[model samples]
Target chain A: MANSNLPRRIIKETQRLLSEPAPGISASPSEENMRYFNVMILGPAQSPYEGGVFKLELFLPEEYPMAAPKVRFLTKIYHPNIDKLGRICLDILKDKWSPALQIRTVLLSVLPYCLLSPDYLIFSIQALLSAPNPDDPLSDNVAKHWKANEAEAVETAKEWTRLYASGA
Target chain B: MARKGKEDYYSDAGGDDDYEDYYSKGEDDVCQSDTDDENSGSDDGGGGGVSDGDDQQAMETTDDIEPKDREKEYDFETEDDVRRCQDEVTAKTSELLSVPPGFAAAFLRHCRWDAERLENEWFSDERRVRGAVGLAAAGRDGDVPTALNDRPLICAICFGGYAPGEMRSAGCAHYYCHECWRGYIHAAVGDGSRCLLLRCPDPRCTAPLVRELVDEAAADEDRARYATFVVRSYVEEGTSKYVRWCPGPGCTLAVRSRPGSRLYEVPCACKHVFCFRCGEEAHRPASCDTAGAWVVKNRSDGETSEWVLTNTKHCPECRRAIEKNQGCNHMTCSAPCGHQFCWLCLGSWKEHSGGNYHCNRYAADKSEFTGEKTRREQAKASPERYLHFYERWATHGQSMTKARQDLDALEGGGLDALADTFGVPPTELEFVTEAYAQIIEARRVLRWTYAYVYYQDPERHGRLEFYVFLQAMAEGAMEQLHKCAEGEKDALKVDVGDYGAVFPAGYAAGKLAEFRERLSHLSRVTRSHFTKLVEGFESGMAEIVL
Candidate 1:
């Protein structure tokens, strides 16, 4: 397998992710590049995008755990924090990133279920959907809409999810 | 005290050699004698005794006197001085707060180097201050477990197994491998001065990665950079309002203005003079606001708008700018608008046809020309007025630059050439150096005076006129002095090969002496004129204004 020369950390994390995937989350390494992963995260239960399956492309740079992993949405989803270019505005991906944070903690694991201590905060995709911080927004128009009338904004997000993230 | 005429001054001082000797004694003597004339009633007596036995006594007295105001206003500080200042502050804070120097430095930085504020907050609520500044709690200072366990442990960062000796942790015992710690510190250091505020790699840990940790883990160059940032933060963020980094490019020196004095102009050791208040080049006659506004106006495209207003006429219909290249009165704007109008009246061209070309004559109504036409005229006049002051300001700036270049040339090799031609040593030509320096100083004053005058309320009639008169007088004297220093020096140069026949024994000496006298006399006149100009401006020409 192309994963032969991968770091032990990456190999262990991939094995764990495949064997015991987080609820509503699935991630597997791509065939060609072990550092590249194909991830599918189902929206949280009560969110507007609950029935939607959001695909994301996550790449572990050479800096790996020292730097945050580069993740972006592959499927089009309407969210205040996600811009039209699929770039997410999350703290861990930027100046707040720490060397100790792992891909699972960044993408999927819930606070209680995370193997890392409960205090090790996880800004998982589901958590981000569950609480979209419109204050620190990447998409200005969506944030304005969300601020002006959140219910209508949520309806528009649901419509977008139905159209673009139907898991066809 | 009687003012000495140019001729009387030179003649009274005696021959060229004697006058040169008088000047070479130094400028301090001239200032001393001037001040003595004002204070002591021994004017003529002291003046006469300047070349005699009293000269030594005068020199000795001048040496004891210092310009007290200048000495108190500002001081130039080197890099070491700034570092010493930082160390003193850090030590005092550390002693008072009962904390390590690293923590003290961090607290000072958090409080913007305000030691008093840090003390206030620390004493008010130590725990809150500690939390805010990312310092560990008091009792947990030495509670970091020794990383000497026998069993291997996994580094959460790299997920690698290492013996306890290879691992490191901050007060919060979240261990990371040495390699991972080094990499993290290196990355943070690369980010910039903010690296000084870096925390531990544990996402949840609030333990600040202090300077000691950085010094131990950072690479050689990164460590040096981090050290630089630490030192700079003290000066740049310190609570001391008096000290400021010299704004000169690549200059590492800092200037400390006096605590209560309002003196804003400071000259650095590098010879770059700047206004301490605004960080701009020293502009004396103009206030900082006027100079700043002038500089901004010069840099912005306001002049381009003015030029467009003067050079091009806007199409009456579309308002697109159109320039008339042809001589015909009928004008056609190009492309889409294609509006046709008379160039003079800016009326429809059809009205001018059938020999009804009366647009040249004044309209009897006069109301048609009042509003827009008058406004355009006023707008055109405004740019012309700005250009008048701007051109003179720019011209003086260019003259100053040229004079500086001349001074540099004289210092470099021109002095030697003049000496060779004049049959004297290079040291004898110091008058030329002094002349160029005076010209440069005068040029700078004159340049900023234009900016000052441009901002003066034009409604104040006699004050501005008197200022202009003073400025003109100074400019005239400066021109004469500049001519003597630049053109006349070249006139003294003769071919070296024709040295023997062209001049006899006393001829070169006589010519050199004459040139020296003219140059020195002009220099003094120019200096006095500019001094008067500055004093007049400083006094706000209030005598005339009243």
Candidate 2:
């Protein structure tokens, strides 16, 4: 019922996301709202958050494709770029967003590598966990901690990932 | 002889109001004759026999000397003028760069409209310039596949399959559906003026979505908005060094200061005058820095510090500020630091027993109280000094508004009524208009003098006194003119209930003529005094001793 009256583009993206789910990521549309998706991203390997599963929520606004999708973390994690309330500081989610970018491209994409799409370099939630940009941080305190003492900050992040992001 | 010659020339022209033609005849003749006849003409004083030629001579002489009187020269340009300027630059850049006007405009914007720099960069390295400007360096030759393909291709955006010709791109192979392109442009335009630099929706593509693409794909409203942003960018960022939009509310005019001119005061066509440097109301006689500081000082809670010094006493133990609303001499500091002290001497209240209060006596600790006493006295004196000038500054500003309102009332309907009462044409009441104009100008100069005096160096021993004297002279002349124009004119007004019943035609005409003469003379005097004040301030009061 929620899928009724959804745009052809959104329906197509949702179908592709379900049939060929990206590696280490799962997303499913909420039953009450076709635009809302419950998302889960596995922390990238070799990162401090390696064995954790981070939950996120994504919603395509009415002005989707024209506007960027709203994505926020639901699980608590100690990352410089993600604030306590789970806002992100990614450029693609804000000013640098292009209409060409799909929900899969933002969450996790398995598009075949091609020369035409040279800018597509695995812009995924796991990639964000792997490379937490501390410079343009959403959390000032976390960024300060990350800048002042990175190794200690990484240990705190690892502890938080184990305590909060570990899916029991 | 030259005055006679000029008068004959004006008379021969047959239009007494041909001041523009008279002025343009010869600057030397006007200046020379102005000096010779201005004093005698102005000094003739309210004589019933004063001719129209003499009045014209007096006014024209004032105009002739005005260029030397003020420093800055500027021209007000309307929004259409700005667009014309933009088009001219776009055309010039297009011809020079050997590109279309749209591309030229984009290139000019990329280089901040510095055509010389764009030309230099384009000549030296075209590819780098193209890349920097977001143009496809691969050239627009065959990159755009506008020809219909055999098979329909899927658009990268919207995930919708479209016919080959239905997809569009900005001279790049990264094609998206027209609907998506329109949405992207709409969103960018809605964001604000940054849409002027909108690039292709493909992230990796360096192709700029030029005006052609916007015109072809953007919605009607977005296209208009994009055009506005383009023109605004040309004025705001392109020629920002010399041109500035007038800060007047809802005014689309701009003022372009002459290049290398250091003048700040700019009067827009909307009659809203402002400082070009600071964008504040035109404040002459005060430097932009001083005017800015004075405005902040006026707005901030500066009096709070002074009030604290006078009304509240700090707790002796914890230094917490405590105010005594209503109580006896004994004061107790609030909780957490409940220090008790005498209000008068700030001595420990423990020493003063009940019904034996003698805290009124000065404490025996002169060294302890000296600094506090001096600081308190200084704080008390500071606001008084500030208020002295502030009250006058604010009074003149209010007077200016009231004078403007009076002028408006006179022009709106009062002039015709007065003309009917005096049995003269409404055009004959121009002296009243001139008087109000003089009052407004004098009030503006007088108001800014207070601001200048507020920041005047106190160590400049006699300079402040001299400047105040000049300000008083200007203000004194202005008040006389204001009274003659406002109060005296009101006295001449025949009551509407008893219109023409009390005063005879001859008596009313005589009164009107006398009032006009006095108002004109006062206007001239006030103008001269303010002119001197401006010159004195402009020269840093060099004639007076420090």
Candidate 3:
């Protein structure tokens, strides 16, 4: 949590995210840890998570910029790709990450889930949530239900979003 | 060639078997390469006909020396050979690309380290080559801008304005502040990206970061990691498909087979042997695909779970595996759960009275497969069949392990007693050491042969009778050898010095000599049997014409 030696690039990015916050999202570094940020992302319109807000925690490790920041959802929402532990199955955070990417870019890139087409951006997070891919699902039960009965799966996802994320 | 040193023991056995045939075949292959080297030299010196003729004569004489005589002369190399091999590629690529060695290495890697392919592609389209490697053509007058040390620039990633001294660019000449570049390069390495080419930060500019710029800006740790990435990229992707790192854990050795060579087992420098066609442990007699499938089928829990599903029922309460051994309606789980239930219906035992036995009626719809009876019969017979062979294989395998341990012990101290009784040098017992090693090798081959037959379904090969005969012959020879060395621990334990006193009647010399001769004879027959079996597989059983 310590930020005694926080790099200038991280500091500058933190100030910019707060000053020019992206639409549908807000993030701020903690007072104790400049590397740690508390984030809130409003669910995209028409998605299962519509009318709800999801809380997430993001941390820049000691090797930030050289390493992707760790991000995990604190609020639980039902989706096939996202696991129960809040891990988003996003490629940009893994093998596809390039140094040209920034925290703002990543957030914008992930925000369109449920609204965008599957191949949009060649990796659409929205398409992933709107239409779960059972082949590479993070939650096996959710994937199975989505495959066996779609209407029931969508109903459970809506219920979860309303219960756990609506007040956030 | 570590193999050369060990091969002498087999040669001394004086058996004109296929074991020696295979050894000489490998040597002959190397001999062909040696002559090719001489031919290239003579062609280069063709202009000076007389001196060239003299040179050719000398080369031919040197080549004529028996490969056996020079076997111990060549030095054995390991991982360092891999590094040297990379250096050769880097040097060749540097010349062709007109770039520094480091830049050349990076560029060659993007081309998958095939220098010939890179050359062909570069000559066909220079512009595409430059663009593909992320280089901008010589920035005006063939000079790459050294460092942006003279002016200031705005970093594209963080939007930080920095002094020109802190800016760098790739071939496209789009510069970014040094801080951003460092972070980007480090992050790329941390994420373990296999992309050897790092592109410019400007979303539109596809120019890759050149090696020189990275060397100047990246930290020592990042630079080292980048170097490793460069080498691995070349070794794994850039080289021929046949080149493979030894699969032995913690072994840094690699081997590259001769082009067009048939797939065979390779014993790596680390002493871990594996099949080249598939990187599994050397499994002979069975083809790579068959062995791989068999290993997976045997290891998966499907068989065990399926057997339990068909043969037993879970306890109604505890859910533990329970077999209905007594064929009774009432059953009590032996576990602490001690739940009682009717085996037929899995219902409460107390409810099973007069007519409750109706649940015992045969369920005709239980199996969907039409050949259920035959399948059940096969299922019952397979393990019994597999066990029949696997047990013998496993026993010999254990014997091999024990023989190796015994050989190691004999070499360590038992040699002194052996030498004292024989009145010969300790080295005289080297043959015994080799005999034990041959036993181990033969046992391993025999073991896999059983596995091969288990899955091969000899009936389909139209030579079931021939397969049975050959299997019997090979197994019979191996079993005799196994019995002599292992089945009776005291039978072949030759502490000749102890035997001298025990056999004061003067039969100790005859006994020890006979023991050595028998060991050699068994090893030879076992070797010949294995060679025939392997030849049968290589020929796809065509030798069994019937």
Candidate 4:
């Protein structure tokens, strides 16, 4: 049985987020699902991912206390920590946790950060594809592409965004 | 294995015997000389260790200040009897329940000598006052020396003989074996609290246990005995006085008194006679023919605990040898207290074998006493009066806990969004005090935080307090957490490079979901709060960026 506070805490947190002046972004659980939420982030003006809103999916686990909720990207974007499948590797969302850390702080750090890092994408992703960084790399083809032809890598990334992201 | 916080209670009471006697007799020693001082100002009641230094010299100081007068000068009291040990273990243990009332209360009064007192008078030394710890080195005057011939290895607190391996040395140069000292201190602060009262084992010396010395000396003795000793400044709680048997061999007697009572009675195998308040063997409670064998039973279910029984040598733990009172076979011990209980209903408290302090912390919520109900009205009967008692008892500390939990709605996936988190179920109806306690707490905490917030941003601070006020009106204290969310996100950014302190329990539950779900649709970060919100973005995303 749901304790009466279940709906209450949820309503309080949502109203708390919406009425607050949180510039260019607002996120909340869809009206139907209490455990899942939809997020909206405005692109940074100085970044390549600018002028676009991005989205992601989050799943809270039963052992939420000892473990972090599993978060994944629903948007298709080119980034180092994010793969084509939208799998993200964040620490605060995983093992290195303290009892003090909470949800809103996680949003304040993770989403905007993934959009800010274009250098890590080139270095880590290039290393992942063309020729592995050996010490660090997620895929080999992009890494091989980076080491062999730098121009080709940028062109390929632009081409991928144009096609997959409707940039064309 | 014991009732909530009860194990230490009785075990501590065992150590309380002689200590309480010491303080009750303390006034007599001082009054013998300064008969006029008997009614001295209450402030002089327990003058911490005698640092009345030069004053003694002016009166001529050659250690003429007897060790027995130490409590009078310092007020490092012993309980008047076992029943009122002190705040440390009074409520949990039946030990105090067994002690006579008067002696225990006297000892308890002097136990909490505050830091202010410890500084201004206790340790000053300029006042010609000296404490009991200073005496082991400074020989006693003409009074009979308390040192027993060989000392028989008995614990000064419990009056029971100490096993060779179980003795604790205190700052006052006195000692109690492992069982008594460890049990006493443990009851004061659960276990390993480093609690310190450091007084003489003779029961009345008021001094620190020179704890540093015991640490230095622990090398040659049994590790367990060393564990028994401790020294700290916090007052002991829990070991309130209860009448108890003197641990003295062949003495086999009990006292009926508490800490502050002026009169006390002691029971002996033949005819018990003793004054616990005055520490004199004057009058006894039991008559000649009505004593001898003491059979103490441990009954998990009973009214008014029984720690000592006369005329029959029964073990305190097993009423098997005892003709029990309305007892049944539902016994148990859960953790360290090893208290017995009815296996099925889990109710009742009982006495354990010699010196064991096992007992229960609850009473059965359902009362079966029905002698007056013979003329029962079957058509319409009233509901039981104690029905709500157990519920209230069970949720005792729930409101103050502030424990926020995350329950995953993953099995069937009907949860639409993570905006809502669950609050604990209130144990009572809407009108109960617990529901309001949360509101009161929220308002109080908001008040304290208001000054700190105002210093950070005066305008934002005023607005924030008003926001919290709205939350209080809407819900209660815990719901007040919702009010801090926006401000918290703002605060998290300013200190992101050092954002370690701002984390709360549900940080990831909402933040991560919002960040990830929203980031999927975003290709830019042009928002203002975006800078503030991103304080944790890099580190937080680092976990999922793999």
> DockQ for all models, in order?
0.17, 0.18, 0.21, 0.00
Query: On residues B349-398, what C-alpha lDDT tens digit does candidate 3 reach at each position?
Result: 55543223334332542232122343354465566686676676668668
Worst 10 residues of 3 chain B by lDDT: B43-52
> In candidate 2, what are the lDDT values of residues A63-126, reduced to their tens digit?
8888999988898988766778786656577666888888888875321110001122335556
Residue-level lDDT of model 3, residues A45-163, one tens digit each, is 76677777878788887776656677777888777557778776665665455556777776666545422322234243334444444333456566556556767877887898889
Model 4 Cα lDDT, one tens digit per residue, B71-130: 232112222222222233322221432322211222222333222222344345512323
Docking class of 2: incorrect
Alpha-carbon lDDT of model 1:
0.66
Backbone N/Cα/C clashes per model: 0, 0, 8, 182
In terms of docking quality, model 3 is incorrect
Task: Please give me the total number of clashing residue pairs in predicted model 4.
Answer: 182
Share of the reference A-B contacts seen in candidate 1: 0.38
Give lDDT tens digits, candidate 1, residues B47-85.
Answer: 111112222232232233233433344555667766776
Ranking by DockQ: 3, 2, 1, 4
Displacement of the residue A165 alpha carbon in candidate 4, Å: 4.4
How accurate locally is residue B339 in candidate 2, as Cα lDDT from 0 to 100?
Answer: 69
RMSD of 4: 36.7
Top candidate by lDDT: 2
Reference-based lDDT, residue B199, model 2? 77
Ranking by TM-score: 2, 1, 3, 4
Q: How accurate is candidate 3 locally (lDDT)?
A: 0.58
